[model samples]
Structures are given as structure tokens and as C-alpha cells.
Target chain A: MAGLLLSPTEKVFILHGVQDDYRSDGRSNIDYRPMELETDVVSHASGSARLRLANTDILVGVKTEIDVPKPDKPDCGKLEFFVDCSANATPEFEGRGGEQLANSISNMMQKAYHSSQAFNLKQLCIFEGKQCWKLYIDILILECGGNLCDAVSLAVKAALFNTRIPFVKAALMDGGNIDLQLSDDPYDSKLLDVGSAPLLVTLCKIGDKCVVDPSAEEENCSVISLIVGLTGDRKYYYPKDADKQQSVESKCTTIGMNGPGSVAPKTLKDAINQGIVAAKSLDEALGQALLKERQQNIGIKKHSYGFLK
Target chain B: MPGPDLLSSQGLRLDGRRPNELRRIRCKLGVFTQPDGSAYLEQGNTKVLAAVYGPHQASKSKSTTEGVVVNCQYSMATFSTGERKNRPRGDRKSQEMSLHLRQALTAAIKTELYPRSQIDIYVEVLQADGGAYCAGVNAASLALIDAGIPLRAYACACSASMAWRNGEPEPLLDVGHVEEAAGGVVLTVASLPNTGSIALLEMSHRLHMDYFKVVLSRAMQGCRDIEIILDKAVRDHLAEGWTKQDVVTI
Candidate 1:
């Protein structure tokens, strides 16, 4: 995390602002900062996305590899999360300084997606018990403003939505060996079922009140923050499809707590509820943005404005 | 001796680049606000981001009275390459690259003015098509400039490979991934083009002594060409950042 040094008076101002439901940047407790997102930016990976939430910049690239499924979960695929806190973000992240923070974020993502309801792994299965597609979600933190978990999870979901797995035909050969043939046409691929992927929301508890998407200054004034991961609604991902609009309620997948301070049980419960609301809105906006971009890119070459714009 | 078909019959190298031609270099400075200076650069398919912090107070152990201490860290993203990497940093290759970056940047920096201070340069390679080290150096130089740090001149790096065409050795400038994979001799040179001083030079594989000068000179030329592009970009950035102040004479 990037350290932000604020004076006692500044902290008091922010704390009072949170109590009044109006933050310094004119955003309410539930309002998030403006974000810029672009998907399929990295050509080398199967899918990639870059998201900038305020000053926190996150780039995620998802790579696919074929591997044998575990004996216990033979019908499912695997999703592995890796977070790399680049030294470019801050000097403290140089060498192995950022490893601990990176591990915590990756662990949160892993736990969030561990449930089948949050993400269906069966869609990635190629040969059921024999082979499966393993997705490696590599997240690169370019900058840390605040609320890193939320930005990372959002970028991961966007990248997974952009992932395209090539169509392959597998046949049982001699001695139970599987023969796989891949389609030559690049467009002949299947998109991942990422509509229900989980998104994490960090709710910073400030002066007995919780605020979503805390800025760096606000985070410095806070003592503890609660992270909640909630599954997204599939209806919002695909636009205007009445059949897909069979409203399925969002479910909680994972909960995490950070900072050295303790919180009351009642405050913790309230914060979790606030987090669920924030995640729901965030997921809906992200899905709409992704679908709109896809629509614009249809039947045309996408001119990627990576980092330039 | 020509081992692979790096050059076509029409004297064009792999990736359709003519001899002495450089790859497309697109760059922007001040991409991030967190760091004092940040830059993103793309050379052909290789993309790199660099951030510079300091001329600030150095730690007690690392402080020096003579000149500013230059610290460098070079790390690649795990998904930057074709094969997924387990660790992004703290590896032998990254450490070596960090040291090499320090050497190249130290030559251009005016370190004597900032005694008892330290400047940290961190370069991250987001895509490793080819010539990643060269792109890293170039991007770091831009970031240092963006920080308003004093430098002798722009330190640019470029790579060149050697190939034989029509019984004559032809030097290929700005080597791409395919040419590098062909196992030809690649010469990487970082230099201050205006000052005409080589900061760091590295060569991979074997090349005959007779053709070494040609390759080195070609790489130096490539550096000069890159310097022109970077200088123009800096000027444009400055012009855009500081609009002319309106003055009224009554």
C-alpha cells in the first residue's frame, strides 16, 4: 500500500465529512471515483484488461493452459490468482517488500472464486476427468491509490469476460489417451461464462460509519476496512435480453478484514451490508461498460488505445 | 557465416524491416500521478513502464557524500512472456538487469549535485516481444527526464543483429523477437548520443571480430535515431503541459 501522510486536522476533516455522508471530493459515502477501463489491451495473452480507478491502476492478463484435473474435482477446471505488486508503483514495493500485500490480495481472490456458484468451472472442462483448462489470472498493480482489492477484482472479471478459448475436439484414443484437435480459425472460439464472477468491494470504516471506495487520504484516516465479495447478476451482462433477465439475487462469496484495529459486531454487520450494495452497483456498471465496448468493436478492428489515451 | 534466413532475397530482414531501420517507438511521460515521474513506452511489440522517485534524502547506510546513490529495479510481469512466470522479481535475470540499468543511467545523471541523496528508478516490462532491456533503458530515461532530474544528455538504447546478405554482412537495427530467436549475434548499446559516450554495451552469441564494429556502429546509429524521437516527444509534452501565458500590454 502507498503511504499517505496527513496531519491530524486533515484527518479530522475527512472523518467529519464521512459522518456527514459527503467526502472531500464531493462524493457521497456510496459514490465511487470515476474509473477508466479498457479490455483486450495485451495482445500476447488470451484476454487482458486495464482499469484505472482514481490513482489506482491495475492491469490483468489471463492466460490459459491445459492440465489434468484433480481427482476430487474431476469435472471442473482450475482458476489460479497471482498478484504482482510492481516496484514501479512505489519504492517500498522494491525487491520483496510488497510480497505480503500481494499474497493477501491473491488469497482474497482465490477464496472468492473458490465457490462453484460464483464461477462455474465446468465451462472450462475439456475432457472432464482427464483434462481441463487452467486459467492463470495475473494481476499487475501499476499504482495504488486506495481500495486495491476492489480494483483488482473488477479488472479480473473484465479480463475473464474478454477471454476466448479455442474450440477443441477431444476423442478417446487407445489406452485411454485423449486426442485433441484445435480449430484453425481464430474466431471459432467460445467466450468464458464470466457473468456470475465475483467482485470485491472494500468498505472503509471511518468514525463509526463506512464508506465505499475510499481515497488514499480517507484510507489513512480509517482504522479498519471490510472487504466483501459478491457474485454479479447475469442479466446486466447481456443487454435487453428478457429471457436472461430472470432476476437472480446476488450472493456473498467471501469476506475479509484488514488493518490492525478491531470493530464492533454490529458495525461489522452494517459494513458488510453496505459492501454488498456497493458491489451490486459496481458489477452492473462494469457489465454495461463491457457490453457497450463489445458492441462498438463488433464487425470492426478495435484500435487499442493502451496507455496512450 | 549466415546460419539462418534472417534477410530475404530483397534485402529485407525478418518482420519486414530493412537494414538500419528501427522499430516503432511510441511513448508518453507522466502517465501516473503517484510517482514523482512516470513514463510508458512501447517499442514495436515490447511495452515498458518506468517510474522515478527522488533526489530525496538517502537512508543512513546507503548515503554518500560524493554523489547521489542511484538505485534501480527491473522487473517483468509474470504474463509478459509466452510462458507464465512464477515470480515477477527477485530473480537472477532481473537483478542483473537492475544492475545494468543503474550503470546506464548513472552515466547520464548529474549525480554530483545531489550528494547524500538517492534516486530510485523502477522499470516494469509489461510485454517482452524483444529488446526488452533496451526498451527498459529508454523508458527509464524518459521517466528520469519527467522527474526534472538533471542529465548530461538523453541516454538511449537500441539493439542490432548481424546477418549476411549477398556475401556481405548486413547489420539489422532494432532486432525483433524472431530475429533474436534465430540465435544471431545481438549487440545492445546504451549511450548518450549528444555526448558520444557509451554507458553500457552487451552482446549475445558470437560474431566475428571483423563484423563487430559494423554491428556496434549500427546500434549506435539506432540510438541516435531514438534520441531524436524522444527529444521531440519531450518538447511536445512540455509544450502541451505549459500553455503560453496570456500577457497584456496596456
Candidate 2:
């Protein structure tokens, strides 16, 4: 993350604004920036989507390929996430400048989607252990506004929803080799079940309240922030805190925060409560948007308005 | 080669196009509001977006007294090709493509006009079916024009492949992914069509020296054809108040 500089007076101005539940940018504490999303933008990829939230631009493409599953996880499939921070975003990302940030974001996404509850990999399996469909979720970071993790997660989820894996016809054994038959019909494909996919929500603690999506200027005012990944149901949060003692039979935890700043115990509770409420709305909005795009007839007749006209 | 089955007995190549015919090219300028200039181009199934950032103050180390430094970066989307690529830009192939992009654009840009300055042209290939380098160059030219940069002429690039048809050597124009994978000799030419001066020419497979003239001329003809299409697009783009919807109206 590039550190933004703000004067103490400026910080106080933002802090005062957050304390009242109103942000410097006219957004409420839990309100997000105005977002523009488009799907089926790239014709070459199996599925693609571009999302712009304020200054943050994220382009996600999902490519499908056939590969043998891991020995231990033979019955499951694979999903790999690769994030590229191109120099087009900023001069700072030139050369190997953005590698650290890119790696951290990819790692966080890997952690969030690591659990089976968050993503069912078994659905991608084509055979018992010999073959499976591997999905390569490539995320391109065009611009980094403030909440990159949240924007990326949203775009990835949308891209996954747009993906269509070609139908596999049959697997026949000839002597010692296996021959796979694939259906040529473009419409004969399977759509991934992404309802349970996790969406990341970044909460910046400004003053005593937490804000969902912070601008670059607002980010400078806060010392620490929390990145919480939640599904639509909000039934659980992955990577439970090891410090917190819990019973094995208990339900999943609902809060995840990361920050260097300390908050009052009451403020922490309030922030967690707000985070839950915000996550639910975000998921619902995302789900509806994806569903609408899916319902629409997406075909060659629909002119692809990529960055071009 | 897929043998005699690729080219039909009617002399039509795969996808039902004549040897000298090019894929449909559609382009738009000034697509993004943030960059100084930006353009998007689709060569058949291949889609590319290019953005121009500057001609502003050059970096301290890169500043030159005689001419402006032209910096280019070419990156393909991970899912652009049939198989997903692990990285977008840092790889050796992308680095080489960036160099080739600079070579073509530099020939067209009037670098000496803006000394001690730098121009950043970034090209992103959203979908690559083949001829990615040519598409990148063509898109960058449009973006440079949209940025209002001083240029000598439109930098046009096209590719040609040689095939034996009925005992006669036939040259294909604007080779697509299918033709490129046929393992025939491919000749790529980037030129200033009006000046008839070539900036860069590369050949992937070896062909007889006697056939070079025909193949090169065919690629040059492709460049001329592309220039016409691009010129029409620019004119139509300007006539439509430079809006995306208006450009795509046709």
C-alpha cells in the first residue's frame, strides 16, 4: 500500500466527519462508492468482467483447462488466483514495484477461499481422480483507489458467475490411454455455483466508528483496518482467531478485524455489529446484480463494448 | 498445417476469407477519461485497449536532450489465450513485445519535437487470437492520435503467411490464430503507408528468398488496407462527437 500523507488538521477533519457517521465524501458509514459493473466484456476468455468503484478498476477473467487433481485431493478440483498490478495504474507499480502488494492480496484471497465451506471444489471434478476442470481466476488491478481487497473480491465473484465451462461428453479408455470427448455446442456448458463464494469487506476504523469503503484521503487518517470475508448467509468467518478459546462444537465466528490501533471494547463490538450488517447488504446487492446479468441473453448479438466503443 | 483441408479448392482460407482479405477491424478513440489518450480496437476476435499517459516531464535518469523518450509496456490478460498465463507483463515474451511496440511507435512519433519529455504508451490485450503485436501497435497509434501527440503518420502493422495453393505460392494477409498455428512462414510488417517506409519487419519461419518479394508486398498491402479502415474510423469517430455509442452505431 502506498502511504498517503495528510496533515493533522486534515485528519481531524476526516475524523470528525466519521464520528458523525457521515464521510467526507457524502457517503454514510456503511455506504459504498458508486460502482459500475459490466460482464461478458472479453470475448476470448470463457468469462470476464470489469468493475469500477470510484478510482479502483478491477478486471477479472476466468479461464478453464483440464488437469489432473492433486494426489491427496484427487476427488476435488483446483482454483488458482493470480493478481497483476500493471504500471498503467500508477508509476509506483512499474517494474517489480507492486509485487509485494499483489502477493499480499492474492494470499488473502487464497486464505478466504481455502475452506470447503466457502467454495465447493468438488463440483468442478469431472472424474473420480483422473481429471477435473481447473479454473484460473486472473485478476488485473488497473487502479488502486482505497479498498482494493473488497473491489477485487467483488469483481472475482462476478467473473466467476459469468464463467461457463464447456460440457464434457465422455471418457473412454483405449488400451492404456483415456480419450475425452467434449461437446462442441457453445450453449452446452455448466455454470459454476458461486452463491457460497466469499466477499471481502474492508472496514476502516475512523474516529470511533468504522467505515466500509474508505477513500485514499480517509485511509491516511486511520492507523489500522479490518478485512472481513463473508458469504451471503454470514454463517461463519474463516481463519478463526487462535487466541480466542472456543468449543469445537460451537457455531462459526462472525467477526474478523486487523489493525494496529486500539479501540474501546464497546467500540469493537459496535464495529463488528456494523460489519455484519454491511456484509449482508453487500452480498445481496452483488447477488442481484450477477443474477440480472445471467438472466439476460448473452450472445454474439450483444455487441461487446470493451474499453473500445 | 492441417493439410489440404485448411484451404478449400475455391482458394478460400479457413473462416472463408480470400488470401488477401483481412478480418473486420473496429476501433474507437478516447475511450477512457482518465488517460490523456486511449483507444480500443477489435481485430476480429482479438480485442486490445491502449492508453497514452504523457509527453510530460521525463524521469531524471531517462531524460534525453535530443528526443523524447517513448516508453511502452505490453501486457496480455491472463485469460486472453486458450491457456491461462501465469503472469501478465514481467515475462520475457511481454518484455520483448514492449520493445517491439516502442520500435514501431517511435517511427511515427515526432520525439525530437518534445525534448526532455517522455510519453508512456500502455497496451493491454484483452483477448488474443493472434497477431497481438500488430493489434497493439495499431491501437497505440490511435491512442497517440487521441492524445494529440505529434506524429508523422499512422503506424500500421499487418501480418502475412505463405501457402502453396495449386502449385502457386499464395500469400495470406492478417493471419489469424488458425493460420498462425499452421506452421507456415509468417511475415510481419509495420510501416508508414503514405511514405511507403517500413519501420519493422519480422519473419517467423524461413521461406525462399525468391518468394520474399511476394510475401512482403502482400503484408505491405495489408498495411495499406488497415490504414484505410483506421482512417475511416478516425474520421467517423470525429464526426460523431467522439462518443463511444456513436462510433459503434455503424
Top candidate on TM-score is 1
- Overall lDDT per candidate, in order of appearance: 0.91, 0.82
Question: Candidate 2: where is the Cα deviation over 4 Å?
Answer: A1-15, A71-74, A172-180, A233-265, A298-302, B1-6, B164-166, B235-250
List-wise, what DockQ does each model earn? 0.53, 0.37
Q: Please give me the DockQ of candidate 2 compared with the native complex.
A: 0.37
Docking class of 2: acceptable
List of chain B TM-scores, one per candidate:
0.95, 0.95
Pairs in clash, predicted candidate 1: none
Instruction: Tell me the tens digit of each residue's lDDT in model 2 across B197-217.
Output: 999988997888998999999
Score every model by TM-score: 0.97, 0.86
Q: Least accurate stretch of 10 residues (summed lDDT) in model 2 chain B?
A: B241-250
Candidate 1, Cα interface RMSD: 4.9
